[model samples]
Target chain A: MNTSKPAAGKAPAGGGRETARRARTRERLLDAAYRQFCEHGINGTSIEAITDDAGFTRGAFYSNFASKEELFLALTERENRARLETLRDRFDEVVAPLGRVAGKPDPELIEGAIADILAVQPDNRQWCLLNSEFKLLAMREPQVAPRFLESVRTFQQELAAMVDTALASVGLRFSVDSGHLTRLLLDHFESAMQEAILAGAEDAERAVRDNVMRTLPSLVHSLTEVRPPGS
Target chain B: MNTSKPAAGKAPAGGGRETARRARTRERLLDAAYRQFCEHGINGTSIEAITDDAGFTRGAFYSNFASKEELFLALTERENRARLETLRDRFDEVVAPLGRVAGKPDPELIEGAIADILAVQPDNRQWCLLNSEFKLLAMREPQVAPRFLESVRTFQQELAAMVDTALASVGLRFSVDSGHLTRLLLDHFESAMQEAILAGAEDAERAVRDNVMRTLPSLVHSLTEVRPPGS
Candidate 1:
């Protein structure tokens, strides 16, 4: 174990390495907390439980996160960032190739992009539970609401930007504001996952995929129009 | 207060009156529990807190509900029934007149019906929080899942039936399964409410009304078509 000195004075030689190690530690703690929070709710789980599950001490947890709520927020940010990155990568791989060869946007290509993006997350049930828990907490706790809203808006804006770029690549743009479009799509996707989980569908993930695929592609098509020729 | 005898050995003259009184007690308890749960979550609250809030003794609570979870489920049923009743009443007041008129479903009537239904709930933030909390609990607890699922399906089916009747009365019907269409509209409505609450909009209720109104009428029109002459 690399027991590096604290950065109280001049920068250490291995500062970059130390920062990477701290990030890994934080990630591990978050993973453990996520599992515990899903199994037993946020209020039911304790900091000690998370630290023990992560194989760390209380000191390590405090150094990383000030409180359980903060850890929850950090987890939210991490999960949202990870999802956005996955979407960006998937969109690039599946839809970017068609960008160069531009005519009217192919329905098949748009459908494929929607399917691929929806398919990126397979563990819909766990995610739905965690996300719902966080949302409820934010709603009830006024102090947490602003920060939670910020994180949500950040994710929405980033996703909206990606959607705009992908659409522009194919000579199309949303008839409504891209941000509004993003919110609508996300609302549908989240609702689909929750419904699938509640219904105890044989394959919750596939249920979400099928439900979304049935309506979202057509909705997207209707919401998009050919870009104007001139700016 | 009627300290009525138990309905054990023989039927009493006041049996019906006693049953009505018991139902009133249950409703009172549920109303109190809903407020407490909204204020300090399901898990954060205790049985004592609920009974105290309802001005009932522990015995009264136990007589009415077996456990907190059971009370929570009862609250869910009561709220769902209340909302359905309100929607039914609102639809009757606003759209039933048009039901007798025989022409293509007026866009204005459809919009008005949608608006009235959405406007029926003024406390979106509280409902969103409580609903999300219960959903998370249901997702985490397997025993609660089946009952919760039943309540959800019951609501969806009843709402679908209403939608079918209303649309048919206006010489139209859902192109898709009425249940599926109901789910889509509900998903959008719930999402819009959550978003408005999270954004801390000046009027979260109005925001939900506006957001749902903007898209749902168009979506509904697209989803419905003229009914077959005989069928």
Candidate 2:
């Protein structure tokens, strides 16, 4: 049950070793589940399939997670956390890059920050497919929807906060509300990425890169140039 | 096999009546299937369920379409046609409104045309859900994906043509390619509408109205104001 990492080399009795082993098993299961879910949809993928793919038995899956849904939710959380961490690290580096003046960030630099934050990878197509399946299922099942939506909202809020911090670091903010801008940008980005994947476009990552590089700088320019109404 | 509309009063003897009746049955089934698929996903709903909802027998469905996939593709074509017709009508109205003076269309009028074309409806949420499901399935199934992507590309090309006509009527064009603008605008609109539905936001139509009214005009302005490089 306790999956938290033990304090750096501070092994207490044999608990640390046991926790480490359990953590490895859980991570392995989650990784395999991600691939399987992407290949075969949620319903198409079974608990036994996930366990067998992970090289673990059904009992091992049950020991670490209650069910497929449980494992999927864990994957969702892990993916979101990993993405946020990547964005934050990239954002931090750009907003305070060496030789940068402490004023409103250059529109190009902000665009570069966004591009860095949103750079696509080979694995992202699978993630996008799996995410859409999860979203459709959540929409159909009312019982699970509230939790799924709550997670989405939480993730959006965290993303907006990071955007705000990144902007503030350069003494600038969106003329529109940062939260609204974040939602708009994220929506636009997700849809574009999804389309590129669905069309099986050659150089999908470059498609995203070329798109954001062209669009975001101009969008940020507009947001920065225009003042809020009555301001 | 012949789903085309019959010429007015130009029927081929007794064949015309049967053809008309068959067309009506097919249309009714497609409409019913749209509702059923929205409520219960593509996989979740059964053929029996669709037939029962349509007040037709399984024979009716089989005779009209080979399977659910066939029915769904037909629905997709129908939906695309309907939407394009609506946009064409509205675009015509704005592009050539009755007036004594004839010149470049006003920016505001073009904006109005765009807004009228994008007006949302109560049923759109359902359609979006069903469409997303279809898209995800198409992505997972290689056999279906090529056809689906081709359909998408055709629809997008048609939309781009409409956008081009609308802009030309106004003596304006996007600094970017019309096709790229069409894709960008569609992606933005669909995602915004999806978010509003997923969040169960009150006044979903109004939310779409407000968001598009605010964002699109500015986006179009940016695209129009700047000249394409070397243009």
Which one wins on lDDT?
1
lDDT of 1 by residue, B1-231 (tens): 978775675757668667898898898899889889887878889999988998999999999888998998988898899888988877656667556657556667678777777767757678778888888778767778789878988998998898788777766777666776687678778877787787778888898888888877766655667788988
lDDT (Cα, tens digit) per residue for candidate 2, span A1-231: 988875866887757688889999999999999988877788989998898899999999999998777787788888888887777767777656411745455666667666666663345667787788887777666555566677777788999998777666555667656666676676767766666776676766677677666766666655653223344
What TM-score against the true fold does each predicted structure earn?
A: 0.82, 0.75
iRMSD values, candidates in order:
2.7, 3.0
Q: Candidate 1: DockQ?
A: 0.38
Candidate 2, backbone clash total: 0
Off by over 4 Å in 1: A1-14, A96-112, A174-177, A221-231, B1-14, B96-113, B173-178, B214-231
TM-score of predicted chain B, candidate 1: 0.88
Candidate 2 Cα outliers beyond 4 Å, as residue runs: A1-22, A55-66, A94-122, A167-176, A210-231, B1-19, B48-63, B91-122, B160-178, B201-231
For model 1 chain B, the run of ten residues with the poorest summed lDDT: B97-106
For every model shown, the clashing-pair count is: 0, 0
